[model samples]
Target: MFTSPFQDYVIDAAQRTVLFWDVMRARGNQYVEHTAQDAPHVLSYDFEPVMAGTDLPSPVNYGLVRIEPPKGVKVDEAKRPFVIIDPRAGHGPGIGGFKADSEIGVAMNAGHPCYFVGFLPDPVPGQTIEDIMKAEVAFIEKVAELHPDASGKPTIVGNCQAGWAAMMLASYRPDLCGPIIVAGSPLSYWAGVHGKNPMRYTGGLLGGTWLTALTGDLGAGKFDGAWLVSNFEGMNPANTHWSKKYNVYKNVDTESERFLGFEKWWSGHILLNAEEMQWIVDNLFVGNRLPTAEVETTDGVRLDFRNIRSPIICFCSHGDDITPPQQALGWILDLYADVQDIRACGQTIVYAVHPSVGHLGIFVSGGVAKKEHREFASNIDLIDCLPPGLYEAVLTEKTEDTPDADLVATDYIARFETRTLEDIRALGTNSEEDERRFATAARVSDVNKGLYQTFAQPWVKTLITEEQADLMMKIHPARLEYTMFSDKNPVMGVVKSMAKIVRSNRKPVERDNPFLVAQEQMSDMIIRSLDNYRDMRDNAIEALFLSIYANPLLQATVGLSADEKPPRARPGRSPEHIELVKRKVEDLKARISHGGVREACIRAMIYIGQPDSAADERRFEFIRSLRKGVPGELEAFKLTVREQFFMLLIDESAAIAALPDLLKGHADEIEQGIAFVRQVASTGGEPSDAVKERLSEIEKVFNTALCTKR
Candidate 1:
């Protein structure tokens, strides 16, 4: 107890040094072992391929596999199937089901049959983006055929890059799709703030798709995904170089497995054909044409997003720098004029925003799986039943006990709240001027692309060989870091032996050790330094982008209008289409008075809950329980209710006026319906003033109807 402070410090420092070396030795061995284990392909699911893309007419290396449910999880084929398409932006597939608490696991545990769309390490010769889309549509069709008795169409979940692919498929072939969940997918590429998101500016700063074409040519027509992975790592230098490794070193004993597991996925890079990569860059990333309906297939099919009829659910996070909420949400603003336009299009759009999860965490985090994914899986049918509108899916933790607590399955409640364009605009920090700058950048990109394709591409392709491309991929910085510490390195042999000895006689310093405290402080300083550099670099890039593209003279030189304005709507719709929509609207209005008690009740409920209503798990459970013995099947009844409710919402005043006729001489039924609605509204907690007012109006409608009947 009376020992000198210097003596304690010396002992702590020596112990930390020993632990640090041991961690390095262990990490070296792990790198070697993970590399060997995943030599061919790394997949988390135990699956059998139902349709291999390589065998299709237009062969690609991707495949559709059915994920075998783990023990204790029974899947009901009669329930809607779930198809999860993992993102293949840079890495190999299977992150969506890499663990038990994942998207696939969540769907399987909820008794739904699950399938996965995954790809191999190499892209097929001459494979294009259109080929991949065709393959995915085939997989979806196969799943639908297999689930003939299912209540509804299969629910497709697409992660990151796959999310946009799913959207394209839904737009092209809406009949074959169901409710689609797109998590961490960027539909609006150029819709980021000035200082916060700098990746959006990279396409502009680098000129454009010209670089993508150059990289592909340098790689002998096969684009290296390592470049994409490197870009992602560069976004967060603190995580890539400091925190990730530091966390493992600090908790080496307990974190070895988790660290190695993730590194395997992170390091498993895949390839894309030059054509595929160029199409993505030209049409999606640099061009920003997907949302505007300006992109078309080779066969002349206009891939308009408005063609999609299935409900769309977008999951994003505010903390996701790669696919920030602005990029994830901006497409809605681009595609629709206003809320009324969305309603007129008859599309139900819902989004959920996580407060602090990163892009990868949106698909792979266990905590996210247990909460958000769980709630989404449980409420798929409810989402399908929601009326055509823009809503935010809000998840709240349950705190107090309620009468229906036992009926609930999860600890959180999922609610839908109405949102508007203004709410979406608030997510970005850009003005009309910023948009004009982006437009100017797009114009510059077009010029650079034209010049490069005509002058540079032929020479670059002529000099590149298959061997040189392979060598370049091998020496990529992201890959070399792992290869340097592998067993093949002669220096790692000694490290392996020393690691074994250290494991045999392991000793750890106490948490309060003086030297350990100093070490943590040093680590924090290093991280902060890297973060500061990143911020400065991003700001500089933004400033340079503005200086080059935002100048009116430069914009005019590039053939852009000098006066800055928001993007104008592209003209493509036929006059016949407008006439058809008018006819449909008149037909919809004519059917406003034709419905039964179930329709009347559900319509009244939606009308009363219109302002903003939140529902807990208990509320959903109660609704399900009330429909136990109603009719042919629960889904059929729910579909009918949804159709009628949507019709009512279209013509609210007329629907309300006609409600008395629908429920004539049924006073007891009307009273029961109001009581049920009140009970459902009370499940979330005490109602807000708006909710109370809506409820009062609903009750007055029924009361007046009863009085008139009497």
Candidate 2:
């Protein structure tokens, strides 16, 4: 180990040199590639290219159109067309169909006709965001026209920023949409877990839209999306600076091709017009407008999340730092007082949060795309079928067999429960005062933004030029990796060749190696030091800024902002189909007390419950969301998991009641697990029939075995 330490210093120094040399070599190699492949893919939305001859419908051509069709995707005319809208936040489109186990791939595999919503760098003449939205509507209409036999409407999938954009489109034209599956969207800007995801707070800390206006001016009326991508990478300095590069370097032999492919797309950062960026910041990030119905497009048209009739299925992740569960969900709190308000509006909003997936994984991770996106695509109808309500989606991936032998295999389950506004509220603990304060912030932002535009924008724009604008855009940190590494240059070709050789010759040390262990230890120490600095920096900023901005006196100066509050609940339950669900829960509880597999099964089925007794009061809130064009049969779906579960187990009670405890001696633990199950059931929006049936059978065995003993 002593010799190893001496050897490690030498190796580390050598590695550092190699790393620096590689960067230079890579840059030289990129010069060659960039010169050679500097050509952009001139987009044409007019022609659909066929890579392979297939029986599936011909793909639509977005020409420079921004959309990609899966190579062998086939469509089922009987099902709704699946239109996946790609985010133009920075990178190009096609991530939706980039893999066979993707959102588009799954939709096509399920026999649903699919389409992509893409765009070009240059707008079509005078095209604006509203124009793009109209184009989306047109694409949906075209798909719908093609599938006249489809009983259901097209289910639209939108990822990240596109999710909110798609939601905006749906709100504008509810008739054209079916279900909107929003993956990793930050609809609720202020709704974040403390101590993490402080990016939203950045604008607030930066003193609002001043920088945005300045950046727009600097870009000569165009806000390069590269900056946005850079910001995303900047949030995770470790991942950006070391982990990412190290992962590729350590696994270069395998990672090179994958890295190149991803970087090709990732580096293809797009540009947004100043008008659009300004709107996004002033309204979304700063104003908090969509949920509040206070936004208007440049054309003077109003924006209202409540106007849409479709159901919205929001898919976010707890581990997703970019668009955390709170950001994805907080808009509900921003928009409505309770779920009853949602029901009164006849909307259906369903949200599913993964326990631990990161932001990109939500859309690109094959497992997630296959299971979550696949199930969501398959059961758009079932989700649409759910009665108007707030639902939590819980997916149970079918495994082969457990070591415990208590379960069966080969299943994909979608469990749903009807929820209320209060239940949705229960997810967080933000008080009414906090919300009021946020509202005040929103109003202040509007005034600040308006003042800047009226007084400062013209001078800023005149001072910046188009050439400088283009130069600035090209060099943005986000685009640097791509622009710097292409195969177009001559020098890069030689270095690329050498790099490949070196990569092939590389072999990592053993996990237990002293050097490897020391490397980890040292890297961790650096990371810890950096984290401390980061905490200190962030706390200093927050403390200084809060004293300056988030103030009671300033709030008082803002004035009368509380008058425009979200809708209030109608007090008690309105006696919708809720009573039936309640009765089912009570019955299921009783059935479980009786022993036997059949009885247990009956108990499981009979007890399927609506988690919130207040569901009926909030019916309007969900109904309104559903009507906004979210997919599924909104009126016919079950509201509670208890109801859904009871429906599953009760009928098969007799057969199961005859057997031993299916959960075995873990009956108490199993029974005690009901709280989580109830929560899962409550939030799980809709289950596919396969899952529903499996739960019934499990209950059957559970009922008969446990009942006889009792």
Clashing pairs in 1: none
Root-mean-square deviation per candidate: 3.0, 11.2
Error of 1 at 500 (Å): 1.1
Query: What is the lDDT of every predicted structure here?
Result: 0.81, 0.61
> Candidate 1 local accuracy as lDDT?
0.81
Give each model a TM-score.
Answer: 0.92, 0.72
lDDT of 2 by residue, 1-710 (tens): 34565465455444443544455455435433432442333222222532211111322223222134445654556667787777878766667776677786777777776666665553332345565665666667777777765757778888998898888888878778888899999886766644666666677666677678778789888777778878887777777777666666444435655665455456666677777777788778876666666667666766677766778999988789898887888777766677656754557788887889989889888888778888777667667755556887766654444221122112465556666667655656344554554556666676777787889888877777889888887676665565455454455566656555655554344456667677678777767776676677666755654555547677667773334443221133337535754675567555443443223322343343322322221222223333344343333233342233433434445423422543455455444433333333323245445545655554455444445446
Clashes of each: 0, 117
Model 1 — TM-score against the truth? 0.92
Top TM-score model:
1
Give residue 395's lDDT in candidate 2 (0 to 100).
Answer: 65
